[model samples]
Target: MILKTILSGKHYQFKSVKDVMAKANEEKSGDTLAGIAAHNMQERVAAKVVLSQLTLNDVYEHPAVDYDHDEVTRMIIDDLDPLVFRQIKGWTFEQLREWLLATTTTNDIIHYLSQGLTSEMIAGVCKLMTNLDLITAAKKIINEKTANTTIGRPGTFSSRLQPNHPTDNLRGIMASTMEGLSMGIGDAVIGLNPVNDTVSGVTAILNTFNEFVTRWQVPTQTCVLAHVTTQMQAIEDGAPAGLIFQSIAGSQKANTAFGIDQHLIAQANQLGKQALQNKGQNVMYFETGQGSELSSDANFGADQVTMEARCYGFARHFDPFIVNTVVGFIGPEYLYDAKQVTRAGLEDHFMGKLSGLAMGCDVCYTNHMKADQNDIENLALLLANAGCTYIMGVPQADDVMLNYQSTGFQETATIRELLNLHPIPEFETWMEKIGISQNGRLTSKAGDASIFMEKESM
Candidate 1:
């Protein structure tokens, strides 16, 4: 009972704290919402969190004054440890790159052979980790750029129109670099196009699979993606033909391919069996960050980072995404994203990562407005990491195809008809390898996933 109450209290307190922070961010009061951290949790955690990637400029900690001080400094430092450590703006990708550059740059290679730290001493390598130089370099770049352009978003890597947008490109390079780190198994990714709330954007992408295989002169593989249990049954009740799967909320097992949101499933089961009674094959896809609204006005769909970080667990129950909106194009009207012509969302930032994972999807697929070149790069990393072997993006007339060949996992399909017009050389290279006919298709052979089940046997 104590534990439950503690958890409940934490949730309640956290919500209240977040609300205060949000208010401060909009600049409605004398205290910035981030400063509201001072009100919610420990001073240290509050300090660090408020100054995260989303609000880097908003934090005003004077290290020289605070750290060099006496008792007060120690008190402040002690509290901020946990919160500041969770970096919001520059995240895992940049941090990992900084670590690599620090330890093994071209200049450092010679030193390694001579007297640099060795694996034996590496046990406590955190002691050697320092990014003062990296920080300087990043700052130097920031300084060189014009003053008006936006850099990164307060909450994500999404860039604003600041003239100092050098950080915008860094996100792509870092994303591509980090692609090598992925273990490449048990992926749960989503593909979304600007919905304008029309489910057809999603349906169109789904229908493309058949055309792809037919053009390739291979048999088509079908899959079902649904959220509601009854929706699953209703679609299946008609006894649909093809690969049908359900994407539930809470229960997710990659091999099982039937886990879904516990809450939604309960709603369906409680509503009666007849709620949806279709029988074919379907998988449930649930959103981790979404609350009651499956569709948001932001039109910017899911959380890409949260998806990649927990892909294994999510696929065990649900694919990471579904049909939704993208940011950037967010406005009152559900008009298409003019910037990303083909579809609406999917690219760098957290959203891009999910799209990247979608490139490797079997049970999930993606569609978005026409994306920019940079967005393409970010999403590509996710696809490559997911072991996608083929692509469906491009036009039937194009001489080349875009393909992401996963060594042993799943394959991805792209939307070729929309992609062919946008000329990206790398994108083209992918096309040539994959062979894009509006109807081309591919799949990933399931690598051994029995290891995840070892605990069950025990």
Candidate 2:
């Protein structure tokens, strides 16, 4: 895999709110960074850790150990640092050299690489080692971004901790996710009345415009889905006439408790469809695996679990009249029949973590990844290299966008006001295929849904 994922510009690509705003027309929502950072936090972390371990074990290594960061931080990274050998908790330059010489590891004293080192710490280290200029440059970039940044609040996306999430990336994206969702949190309930029922027959479907996310024990951001497949329809159909709305609403509420955020609505409009299709290449994929572990949807129960196992994509390309469900309702067991499937040997506890590049969040990390998160990073690198865009089943991924409430999809805003979000260029046509209206604000007849979802395969 490539060492880093570079855009056409080669440097890490980032666009502020203003950048996208400048390009948008009256009908267009100028911001859509979701296309860029759409990958899950866990997947990214998994990729990062895997890459770091691969690099440290093979490509590069510090000649000595160092103790400069927090006490826990120092211990966690001591074996790999190169400048300070023994003394920690603030050591002078003289103390640094003497300790390095005393250590048996190496006298060559090459590079010092550590995790969670703030730009300030890097600057101090830079002052001591003139040869390590590259580190200084990287640190400078970090310093500029965090110059006056505030921290994430409790129950916020950024505040939730990943054992080894890159601090810089986490801080930046969490803020964005938290803010976006905070702005407009609304779900449309699409219920239809059928001609035959004594009571008004209806089914509720949920939909939302922001990049949908969910948690899978650990904070991971991968591919999450708002799907309505044969299985979902059966549930909706089986329920009482008017009760379908309550059922859908209850399902969503339940999902929220399990770290899943689902919205009920008609399909996207014309432009919105294309955007979702373009960005969500693996729209229907989820984290699959054998046995109930940390990744088990069993924690969510049968009704929800069935939703993940049986639901297909909402688009007509898969099935028509489909409504998207929340994230938690799906889990890992749907992915594998064998108990052997796992990520980093964590026993597939994170059953939701697996599959797809840009379109997944719940890939199974199992017992193995938990044992060594570097394994997770390596995974991230592979997915990043593959050009895949998302991951859904990890906890951090969902929390990164939701709990923080920094910036995300809000129901009240128009296409322009919502930052980094846009309706698909041809969303309405896609909705029409299901007999739904253009804006997703109107509902179609129940018989129409039965006709639209006539196909069972995705």
Clashes of 1: 96
All candidates' lDDT scores? 0.24, 0.23
Please count the clashing residue pairs in each candidate, in the order shown.
Answer: 96, 116
What tens-digit string does per-residue lDDT give for candidate 2 at 1-458? Answer: 22333333433321321111111101101011112221333333332322222212221121111234222123223322344432232443233323323434231222222222221232122222222222222211110001011111111111111111122233343343333222211111112112222211112211111122222011111211223332134333442111121112112323333343323222212212333322222222222222221233222222222122111111112212112222222222222211211221121111111100112222223221121333333333332222212222222332322221111121112222222222222322333343433344323331132332233311
lDDT of 1 at 374: 42
Worst 10 residues of 2 by lDDT: 142-151
Which segments of model 2 are wrong by more than 4 Å? 1-287, 290-361, 364-372, 393-458
In model 2, the Cα lDDT at residue 230 comes to: 25
Q: How big is the positional error of residue 132 in model 2, measured in Å on the Cα after superposition?
A: 32
Instruction: Output the number of the lDDT-best candidate.
Output: 1
